[model samples]
Target chain A: MRTEEQANQAVEEYADLVRRLCFMRLKNREDSEDVFQTVFLKYLLYDGTFESAEHEKAWFIRITINSCKDSLRSVFRRRTLPLEVLSEEAAAVPEEHGALLEAVLSLPDHYKDAIYLFYYEGYSAVEIAEILGRKENTVYTWLSRGRALLRRRLGGDCL
Target chain B: MNQLQEALRGVAATQELKEWTRRRLVRERTRRRSAGRKGLAAAVCACLLCLLLGAGGYRFYMSPVSYISIDVNPSLELGLNAFDRVVQTVAYNDGGDEIAARLSLQNMPYQQAVDEVLSDQVFQSYAAQGNGVVFTVVSGDGARLQAGLEGCSGYYASGGHSYLADARCLDEAHTNGLSVGKYRAYLELSEYDPSVTVDDCHHMSMGELQQRLEQCHEGAQSTQGHGHGEHRHGHS
Candidate 1:
């Protein structure tokens, strides 16, 4: 199993990526926090070693996305919440970025993941395809459609 | 940077979440280490218990609790465990060594082993020549010793005598490098002639020892008769 030192180092390096992925998928702080903790715990128990820093970061990305998907699929998370409650929890960023963040969160799950990896994490369509286990063409389509939707929601060329 | 990249950069993880995850990982590692230690301890305990049982079983099966000394011209003893199976064999003379080397008596029941010894070709030849075979059984349990003697006597019904002896004398007999049967004969012969040592008796055949004992008895009887006659004549 990975040592405690390795676990601490992974959490420090990847916590932001995991939290942002969880928030985009689940759209609530409480469930995002749960999946975040679950992701780091899994890293601590994983016995295999990574080939490079890129491989390790890809591992964390895949695991965090999978954990978020599992949390969203749970019956407890299926319960509907007030729109105001969800918007208040999702608005953890600066006031000026809240609108853009909300628009990103509102996209289809596949497009949201593609957009986040492509724009914020600075991954190309090909790299995003590998991380999300999709064809490169599929990732490109998701990113293109996601940006068009974001432009419509914000109603400007700021995207 | 693009506008979206600059906006998304503001939505990073908070300090509280990172701290909570670090504390949780530490707690999980501790729990796993404790469970691993407990599993190791259980495995060690199981191995030690198996070793103890194995050693105890070996001792119970291999230790001897009784002995049967078969003495003719060949003097040897068979050591029996609690189940009356032969666990050891020791020869006190060259003939006995040959007989012991020729027979596979270990783990055989005492009665079957005695039959094997008595029916041996060399032993039968001596018996055929009218040499007396003596069986001396030594055991702490009286009833078991008597039962063993009875079973031994049946093997050589005419040419042998079977009797019980004290277990304590067995150690003394071994110290003098003799089987208990020969040792008993030595004790009797020593009474008649103090010059007769255990080594002399060890080399002597059982037939020679018996003959010498008989001569001693006759000499004592004749002396007593002559003394009584002389005393009666004086009284008259």
Candidate 2:
């Protein structure tokens, strides 16, 4: 079991990782916060131990994915948050890129998951397959399908 | 190339949780540690006491006693371990009539076991005395009492179906509603003896209640057997 101080330090160091995991799935700030707390509470209660930073990151990713899936299953109520709800940083980005990211979120959950893991986290297809409990070929198919859908939705500008 | 990543970086890095949540987790962790330490200390003290008692070799005297009635539904009674006290009296409502029933659940394990059983038809049918039923478990402050009834409804619905499925009808009797009999039970969880008291408010006989409970239990066993054989896998 990690000491409380060590756990808190780990949370602080990986705050951004946790935040991105939540943002990528939930697409809302408040819901992500709830998932984040639940994940840490679970980590503390279960005495989750890791050998290294990569192990910790992988565990956190798995937990985040499970949390998001659970949220989707249990909380079916739609949150009416708008697409332009990002910070001034995202607002400062080119409109075309922003639109592309929005289109990515609109994809089906499997494709969205594959695309996010591929581009955002920079996981290889095989790693995505292992992480998602799917075959490598399935991951490749989803990535290709997701990219094609995005290109189609974003038109010629996506290329 | 990295501009998209940078834009995604800080914007995604919002303060994820409230300060209170962190404080709550810390407090809970500390409390759990302190509680664990206290439990360890208590265990050591108990061992020391036992050692001293053994050195003295003075055997603790015991008494022999018999209970007045072997209450099939003990949760309805009030008293000590023997369930000889009446903590409170209650009259439950079922349909249009007020039936005389009592609630009592003393032994928590018995209550828990009975509740688990009742949550399935097999166990619940056994607890029924005539039209009245007994509740074995009473959780703190009647919280378990409320949940217990809802659990019974689900149990009954499933039990009804399974019971029908097994019966060899002339043409597999297409009866739509058989287990619709309203069950009126008295539930009580006291500081002493906590058990459920079920009287036949519906005037159901001892034989009918037993059969129902037995059939349900049989169905539950078969269902459990089925669940075990088919699916034993979980996410890796």
Candidate 3:
């Protein structure tokens, strides 16, 4: 069992990582915050012991992605969020990074997840595959396709 | 990291996000502890309830009662009270209504009630399956009820064309100590393995008998059926 002090430290350390993963997948502040809360609560309740900090980081990344997927598959997401909500989210992002964010979000879910974990979060395709529960080759394919889409949208120079 | 990756990393975890997560985790811990206590209380109550029920059920089960189930064509379950009188008669099928009409079933000893049932032509006509008859005896002393069932039916060669032959097969199986209704399903199967005697099959389980009887040595060996050569045997 984790002590109160340990639990506090975990929230402090992993909150940003979980938040970023959630934001990258969900692409909405409201949904990301909900997933962020869900991910940490699950981590606290998780009974398994970790071998190292890397293992612990992997755990947070995997669970945060799962939380984001769960929110996306939820009835509320299917019923409520659409082009209107997505456009609002696109508008909310900083205008400077607007095209990049739009291009990343416009890619299919798997490609978006792969590209974010690979480029932005500095995860290898092997690590991304482990996090996403896909074959490493599948992750590589997603990354290649995602980069191609990004180049098409933002031009090869920017990519 | 690339320029894009470096810029994205600048989107740091806010103080608000940290504080909110801390508060939520604390609430989750409290709620889990509360749920734990409730679960413990519920488990204790369940154990107590089980103990009480076990004791009460043991007593009711041991009470002196003769449970005579009368099955003619259809089956009728009779629960006899301490006085050996019919207190409850439950019909499992529609044919039981016919047995109820033909037999004066109330207020009789186990044997007497059986005699009363046998006296009815409808009772004689009732073949559980392949003219099989099931008589289960359930007795209790007010703590536990132990039941012994005798299920017997005929392995009719005549495909029920001969009612007497079918009854004889029932008698034959009962004499050999085979469970009547259950083994009736294996009636056609016996033709496959005629070497396995009824006595050999008597104590074997339904599945065992079915499996054993399933082994036909050389396709189907011809045999003298119920009517020919004393197929009817006396119940021991």
Best by DockQ: 1
Task: Tell me how each candidate scores on DockQ against the true complex.
Answer: 0.13, 0.08, 0.08
Tens digit of lDDT per residue, candidate 2, span A55-136?
5676567556656655532333233234344332234335646776666655656677787777777889987776654567
Q: Which 10 residues in a row give candidate 1 chain B its minimum summed lDDT?
A: B227-236
> Once superposed on the true structure, which residue ranges of model 3 sit more than 4 Å away at CA?
A75-78, A87-93, A157-159, B55-236
lDDT by candidate, in order shown: 0.72, 0.44, 0.55
Ranking by TM-score: 3, 1, 2
Better of 2 and 3 by lDDT: 3
* Candidate 2, residue B187: how far the Cα is off, in Å: 30
Clashes of 3: 13
Tens digits of per-residue lDDT, candidate 1, B1-236, equal 87667776766788888989899889978987896688578646755774789976556667788888888788889998866789999998888898899899999988788888887887777655444577777886533443344334234242455555677778889999899888877775676677898878866788789778656644543443233422111110
Place model 2 in a CAPRI quality band: incorrect
Better of 1 and 2 by TM-score: 1
Question: What's model 1's TM-score?
Answer: 0.50
For model 1, what is the error of residue A83's alpha carbon versus the real structure, in angstroms, after optimal superposition? 3.8
Arrange candidates by DockQ, descending: 1, 2, 3
What would you estimate as the lDDT of candidate 3? Answer: 0.55
